[model samples]
Target: MHLHPQKSLYDLAQQHHLEGLTLPSLLALTKEQEGYSIDKAKRFLAFQGRINNEMLNHQVIIQNPYTAWFEQGDQNPAQIKAFIIQFSVFSNQFLIAQLHKMIHADTLESMHASKEILANEIGVRFQSGQQHENLNNQSSTEGSIDGSRFSFSAAHFEWLYIIAKKLGLSFAEIGQPKHGTHATLFFCNELIRLYGGDNYQISQAASYAVENWAAAGFWKQLIQGLQKYNDQTGLDLPLGFFIWHDKLEAQHAAHTQEELEELYFTQNLDEDAFIQNGNEMLAGVAAFWDGLEVQRQELATTH
Candidate 1:
């Protein structure tokens, strides 16, 4: 459903305040008011399962020739550079989508859920585990003024920046709109327009599709190619960005499931619209890979 255009972000934030209410308390209140239906929730889960299966088999990124070439350990400097620059366009704008999700969430529970994801995106970690300690030690360049550990090491985009720098990309080349190809720019715009847009359900659907897409092993494929490239070129590329995202996206599969369950339980969903928007978002993603493939072919012909 379309949210009121005039509602400021602050207004939406105010509306979702937990006010000392625990998750269970908020969920109970929502159920009491919304008249929770177990049967409906089950139906939604079934539909969601179909969508997840479809995403797994989606030939867009999964079967794209460019993806296959990269996975096969092909290393073309020009093509790889193009991929890095274009992907940075998407990476930098992702925060806007997360912000939109949090602000446009219909319920406090959903808002909190979105907030947690955003927190992770922005480098907020609740647990100071061994892995984090390793990250802190490894990211010496990101040390603060006093040489203390900073949270930027955990930030996803910061990791991307590190990857870009290792690949010989300048800051201006990574995220600048002018550096993005037509399909890459379209994909980035689509993320904000759908995933970060004011339509709460559509945004959720788009995000669900994206989470599933990420969990479908593309990151692993890219990492394999990148590792091979590093070995062949002796670049010693720090692949923490791809590696961390691969792990996180695996976890996001469960997170997306919970998000959908919460959405099913707490709000009335337009299932048809949700499905349609999700496919549309994936189409944009397909275009992105298609664009890269076109460029890869062009580079091949020149050689």
Candidate 2:
């Protein structure tokens, strides 16, 4: 029952000579030895509540003037193109963060869970939610998982690229890191450092924070703007990418709730450290949006 700063559940089990135990066994052992308390559960729930509230009210997405402008419609094509380019840069680098999460996972179950997410990112569909069986499959080489083929066409970035192309953007324009604004590049790098790094607690908290951010309805906001732009300009922007993310992020809300419970209840968390990392990750997210806002303003003045 001894707590070690920043150590994972697996690390704690190994420290207590309880190695090789499954997640359920480890949780039972920890709860039995520590004497489960309702007060502790309440505190965990309160912590989660705070994180959710923070994301819901985060100024970066909720209060950002750019989001309002975009939602209102009739956006300049240049501004829209700029948004796509920077977002695509961020999206393309996200797969590396997922791989890092899988590699740094503290348990087999966590690793497999991370792999499932990576598989989905790269366009691997699961039948009956049976993704664990193909966690070992090489997805990078068009591998098949449970009869679902890994296809470049299905990748999330490819979806973004398709949208970008409809806006007359070329591959070099959307895919290159050199085109990202300072804030955009900084945000992508922060994802690697916090979400993809070796610190399991920090990574978990960052990932959880991001899922909450996505669930806060930014995708819908963007879609509103895009739909308006299409109506005003008579240009058909394929919105399937944003629409798909809106649906997926809604589902991620539940997934993140389960992740938080499993992480907080089973692991010996450095609560303050976890909160700090989540805040830091959100700051990066804010910066990315703020950069886009800057561009939007500049375009507004010119137009």
Among the numbered candidates, top lDDT falls to: 2
List RMSD in Å for every model shown: 10.7, 9.1
67 Cα displacement, candidate 1 (Å): 1.9
lDDT by residue (1-303, candidate 1, tens digit) is 327523432343246542322233344444464634434544655666666565545787457677778987776787777778777777766777678778887779768777776766667654422334454333321112222233876676777788788778887778777878899888888988898788877887888778877877788889999999898888877888787677767766765666666676677877778778888889888888889888888887442
CA lDDT, candidate 2, residue 235: 85
| True lDDT of residue 65, candidate 2 | 68
**Total clashing pairs for each candidate:** 0, 0
How much is the lDDT of residue 118 in candidate 2? 85
By TM-score, the best candidate is 2
Residue pairs in candidate 1 whose N, alpha carbon or C atoms collide under 3 angstroms: none
How high a TM-score does candidate 2 get? 0.79
lDDT of each: 0.70, 0.75
lDDT of each residue in 1-303, candidate 2, tens digit only: 457532566775666554433455456445564533344555665676666565545676457666777888867878888889988988877888888888998889878878877887878755454334322231332223446667776677888888898889898888677988999889988998999989888898899778878888788889999998999988888776787778777777766766676677668888778777888898999988989999888887553
Task: List residue ranges in candidate 2 displaced over 4 A.
Answer: 1-36, 49-57, 129-146, 301-303
